[model samples]
Target: MVTVAVTAVAAALVMTGCSGGPSSPATDNVAGTPSSGASSTSKSTPTPTPAVVDVTPADGATGVKPTAPVVVKVSSGSLSEVSVKDAQGKAVEGKLANGTWTSKARLAPSTAYTVSVTAAGSDGTPATTTSRFTTLKPAVTATYGILYAGQTVGVGMPASIQFDSAVTTPELRAQVEKLVTVTTSPKTEGHWGWLDNRQLMWRPKDYWQPGTKVTVNAPLTGVQTGDGKWIANDDSASFTVGSSMISTVDIKNHVMTVTRGGQVLRTIPISAGRPGPETETRSGTKVIIRKEGTVIMDSSTIGIKKGEPGYYKIKTQSAMRVTWTGEYLHSAPWSVGSQGSSNVSHGCVNMAPENAAWMYANSKAGDVVKFTGSSRVFQPSEGIGVWQYSYANWVKQSALA
Candidate 1:
């Protein structure tokens, strides 16, 4: 406080003697004298209230994730204002709830962002703070897309994607998966499940209905995967489902019957696995994944040594792969006599050249090739063999479910 006091005093004016020595004599200092028209006043200054503001992905942060949110909190008062923007002054969308503020928009890669916050304390005292940060720069970039030969897949077919680089972490994989959108024309529902870090596949709860249309969108240019891998560009694909064409092979009878829409189309002579375990074909519903004019058959690929009795490698024609365990339906001129007469093949379906060519030409990816009369069961991971598992069991493999 400051105080000012003045005294009021009435004094008479006295004329000094006309002495030449002193024209004006000095007057004594006023002591305990009152001054007229004097007043006193006092004033005090008020103290201010304390304010608080906290921000995360702290101020001056560098190499932050693009998906990282800008979070701000205020104490002793609710949030009054917040602004987040990029280097070009483009605003970053966000929302304020209670005393906290969060960024709604995903940040950009290799870009700088500035955030400012304002609030007030209990006594209306203003508070303000700011932060600047930069998102991590990508070192390598790649693209990815789904694969369905001829743009027509079977009901049992899974939507598969192959990435140029591996995405190992769950969080980073999820961020990349979010950029992928799948929509079906018939409105069927499905979910994506990661077979490995790099391979992703989606399938409906049950087999896709015949004639279903599928659309895939991967707007992934700025989407980041683990290990500094970012999407270089966007990708999209649309494919359709074909009629229900399925085939069943009975190893005991040495025959395979092809069917479509619950009607038998043809019954062809075929030779399945021999009785012994060393040459027994797995019995289960398997999807025909590929049909090439010629495929190099190798015994070592399935753990059979070169000197082993059943070991042999041959470039076979009209090859149609049914499983990853070296199982195929192809021409076997050498086994022509044994085909349909006896099961003499080493875990593969053997037929005459004309019959094999006819089957291969008509079959496409996702066509079912079920085998019976075998003791061994087909592994679900074997080439597109998604039908081996029951519908209830298949949904359990999905990551999103």
Candidate 2:
């Protein structure tokens, strides 16, 4: 009876422990199986972001200066390509380096431009961006002209560029100088100088070599001359340097000597300016600007009116202009007897009709005419008086100096 009672109590304890209740393996100690209450979740990696592109002169921006550079920047990847197009669908030149792109060519004023950029992400995914902007319209569009264009000139003739508006400051003038380019066939050495605010001229250290071919390019359409002023037109010219034709006029002795390539061509009787301030030919180097066939000489153009002391209007033949102030080497028939003797005319080199015709027929524009022995000096600001200044002094007039 005692053994049966003990076995019954042990059976009751085993049944209680095996019951699917609070003590059934504690719900986490299951064999060969993971528990739902414990953390056994697998982790997954996050996805990477794509590349980003940024453009300068932001999209739809207006009134942008042409000088402002177009820039493109990329992040999280490498730049694939960049394209900038104008309204005409012409591509703007640009360069890319170190993941950045910048415009290499100048933009036009009052024009619309479109920029398209494409880049690749680290995951080899390509992304694109675009921008549109318009350049500012200049208030005053300046104009310019290239001198001695399409002509054969003398060795002493300098390449001249004249602007309608004045370039006020030296800094502005330097900017204008940067737009000019000159080239020679034989590769001559030369430099540019400003005789005044409106005139920019290029001359060699010495006279140009005969038979040299010169070409000039001035892409000044986008150049700024002053505040609110921008050049709207580009200019270019090609000129040839002809044979060496230099003439010397001796006022004291009243004679004119012509030479061609260091050899004496002819010695002609000539009468130069008489003694006086208002009626004396300027003494210095002069470049023949143009040949006028039959010009009416009016003293009023030189500030001498009808009733003035030296006022006279006459028609001269075979006239070659040497100065802006009413001076020329022309045919003066009335003063033929005074030729090579006494200087008795206005500020002009009077020669016989035959002599004047011969000189005009043989000479071209840019021929050198040098006059000596006079009280009045030729100013650099006068007609193509570039030879008056030494090469060193002429260089000092440059904006860069």
Candidate 3:
């Protein structure tokens, strides 16, 4: 009976060890089985932070200036794309460089704009942002016009910009001048000078070479000229330099010599202005403003009355205007005998009928006319009198200088 009991107990111990009884459940754990008291837990990866974007003219902004910058930048990421559009869905030209996008063109006033941007984070997580803004409505809008547009002007003519509203302050004038672009073929050197409050002109260091091509672009729309005034329109002009026509008038010799391309064309007999306070022809460089056919000459335009000593109104022929103060080269049939001998007219070059017609026919606007032997001086403010100053002196008139 003792032997049977011992054998039975040994068999039971082996079964408990091999079969993994409740107290020995660790053995089942080695075989990839779960135990009652043990627990299973797993590790998970974390989500990445999103990219951030910043926009100028903040979202829903109103009354922004048209000159204000439209820009987009990204942080904690890289910019992928950017778009800026007007109310009509026309995209404004822009460029992206160094992770920033900037608009290249100026905006229109009183217009709505929308900006959209997309970016990706360091972990390639994408984010998008949008902005909307409206430009301010100017109280007064200014306009500008170009002189000598589409016309071949003389070599002495400067590219002129005339503003309807005066740009008074130097700070404002500099802003306007900076935006005016002058391009020339063969790359001529020039500078812009403010002739007056309303006129800005760009002239070459010397007379332009014949056949030189020039183009002026004034992107002045939205440019602020005053507290409440802004430029409403832009202006552009493309003109060319015509043949070099220069005429020299000798008041002492009483003769006018015309030259083209450095060759003499004509030596005309002329009677210059009589020697007096308001009647003597100005002695300096002058440019032809325009040609007037059969003008009704009146002394009153030059501040002389009918009964004044130098006052006389006559019907003239082939009148070419040279000064705003009423100086001209016109036909004086009455003084034909005195033309080559003496000066007899009142502040005008008195040429014979046929000679005056020849001059008028051959001349164009901005032809150079130099006078000698007169004591009266020509003021630079006169019509197209840019040659009155040396190149060094003229460059000082620039706002940038």
* CA RMSD of all predictions: 10.9, 14.6, 13.6
7-101: candidate 3 lDDT, tens digit per residue: 11112222221333446644555756654453445555444545677888888889888788888877767888899998789787789999888
Computed on alpha carbons, the lDDT of every model, listed in order, comes to 0.76, 0.85, 0.84
Q: How many clashing residue pairs appear in each of the predictions shown?
A: 6, 0, 0
- Tell how far residue 103 is off in model 2, in angstroms: 1.3
| lDDT: worst 10-residue window of model 3 | 1-10
Point out where model 1 deviates above 4 Å.
1-61, 70-134, 137-144, 162-181, 189-199, 218-235, 276-278, 305-308
How well does each candidate superpose onto the true structure, as a TM-score? Answer: 0.67, 0.85, 0.80
lDDT of 3 at 216: 96
lDDT of predicted model 3:
0.84
Q: Using alpha carbons, what is the TM-score of model 3?
A: 0.80
Task: Name the candidate, 1 or 3, with the larger TM-score value.
Answer: 3
